[model samples]
Target: MTKNCIYSIPESFLALLTVFISSCLFAQQNNSDPKIQNQFWKNVQFGGGIGLGFGSGFTDISLAPSAIYNFNEYLALGAGVQYKYLKQRDFYASHLYGGSAIGLFNPIPEIQLSAELEQLRVNVNLEGSNTNSQDYWNTGLFIGAGYRSGSATIGGRYNVLTDKNNIYGSAFMPFIRVYF
Candidate 1:
């Protein structure tokens, strides 16, 4: 509330900022990674295009793009985002949110596993009048098993969990997944 107080506050604020800036500059100048510059791309991958899945409230295919990481020949992991068509006996093609998680084979063999979760909200107009709409959220889970070779992966997953908005059923979504 006074001129002296305002002046005192800025002095300490600037001093703290100066120390933080100097510390970051010092840290950057002293770091070293032998392969950081040349081998950076080996740790990343990409997957894309049409995909398929089947489960509760979902029995059709979809399109997806994914990214992956390779830790070693026996261990790998990945994540992906997808735009999916949820197949309900009563509904047509709709928008859904989906993601993928993968676990690679161990012991140097041709086998792998994965888990995926997909969710979406659908709105319906009562009396089909297009005035006010009713919204419902549907989610499904897929736990898969399969094989991997370098950049491609194929697997099948069962429904580990499903939150239904209407009539509920139980099934496994046997799906083929590709990792990049």
Candidate 2:
């Protein structure tokens, strides 16, 4: 019985080690395969969105240019600039910095959701005593979704100044995103 006990102890330890090693191998296999890894540099991406704005007695559209640095299989950081033009009312522009992350929820990927915020300079063509000049600052929120493969996104946003100058509205934009 003593000999049997010693022999079983080694066998049990060997079994545990085998399980540990195999589990690690399984984990590696479960991650995206070589093809996915190669495509990862498609990781870094750049894109832009355009939107139309209404209200405040203006007909306006906005152009947003953006850049992203993807850091991993599921996370990225980005910054964007928006230029808004009113046919004859006001001009508004802003620069935004933010981060993003994506999750593959299904094998047939089709959609993604993202959120963002922007530190903003709310500028407009204010009729000055002499000339029109911008005179406001604010922060705002942006939220939206993307349909994979289409390089298109639709989003809505709003902005308000800490001092009560409000530029609140929504926009619709189609985007073209290219990954490198």
Candidate 3:
């Protein structure tokens, strides 16, 4: 009678294990249903910046277009292209064109933080009697934070790497970002 009791206990345990395994498989199948999956293109956002300035002997015009892929509500990665034209009277004229990659995070709905790596190819031509031209590359790493609105962010970013040859005159710059 003790042997029969031991054999019956194993059978009971096996039945319970089978039921548990079946339930788990059913849940997994429901989660993997194609109707519930997220599409890739739905996660993309596009935005950029534009600037124009004119002075006595200086004129600056710039255009930058960018796109980002948001993995969720909090994190995004993006890239952009930039083109800028500048002319300073009796000093120099230059054309800058390049691209940048950026990563962004939002801890709360009202604040956004970012890190960006930018590279620009610069071509400078001396004005006045000398018509010498020089070409080089300028790179910058920027870290920044900003206040967020509906689809726009207003913030300031500081270049972690800036020197005499850096494109932007200041290490700190205020920015406005808009995306849709």
Candidate 4:
């Protein structure tokens, strides 16, 4: 059973990699048309968030990268990938990786509303005489509102499905995003 669980990680990673590569290729193909290429590049944005923490016995790190395309002034859609690692001194470690789809609405120039749906695979390893490990999947939905400036956004979100085993840690999460 453990071996089967371990195998799933590579499978999942491969699947995500395929999607990522396909999207990039598709975008490149579409760019062959000058008008479409200009419009596409103009509407596309890149941004994400990072988290870091360290203490005497523990460390946590998170990175999320995303791309967004503005369909119009009021609507935008995007995809993102996330990676996180956490460790506690001589005790245990965990790795999380996932992807998400995001939607955003801007009713005004400075306020934005957003929603995200994500699927994450988490693996935990226990360091001890027994040396046990486990893997599982977690799905989450988040809704949030934020203040948006020219190229920066700050927001807080609430996970409606607050599973105790979630790698995100809490029902509420804060984020800072900068687009280029």
Per-residue alpha-carbon lDDT of model 2 for 34-114, expressed as tens digits? 787777557667776677877766566767777766665345567777666554433433332233332222123455455
Ranking by TM-score: 4, 3, 1, 2
Q: Which candidate number would show the highest lDDT if scored against the true structure?
A: 3
Which of the predicted structures, 1 or 4, would earn the higher lDDT when compared with the native?
4
Q: For residue 47, give model 2's deviation from the true position in Å.
A: 0.9
Model 1: lDDT equals: 0.63
Q: Is candidate 2 or candidate 4 better by TM-score?
A: 4
| Candidate 4 Cα errors over 4 Å, as ranges | 1-33, 129-132
- List candidate 1 stretches off by more than 4 Å: 1-27, 30-34, 51-61, 85-93, 98-101, 105-107, 122-134, 163-170
| Local distance difference test values of all predictions, in order | 0.63, 0.55, 0.93, 0.90
Q: Return whichever of 2 and 3 wins on lDDT.
A: 3
User: Per-residue lDDT for 144 in model 3?
Assistant: 97
- TM-scores for candidates 1 onward, in order: 0.59, 0.46, 0.76, 0.77
- Model 3: per-residue Cα lDDT over 1-180, one tens digit each: 999999999999999999999999999988895644656667888999999999998999999999999999899999999999999988999999999999999999899999999999999999764547889999999999999998899999999999886778799999999999
Q: Rank the candidates by lDDT, best first.
A: 3, 4, 1, 2
Stretches of candidate 2 exceeding 4 Å from the true structure: 1-42, 50-61, 87-108, 128-134, 155-164, 170-180
Clashing pairs in 2: none
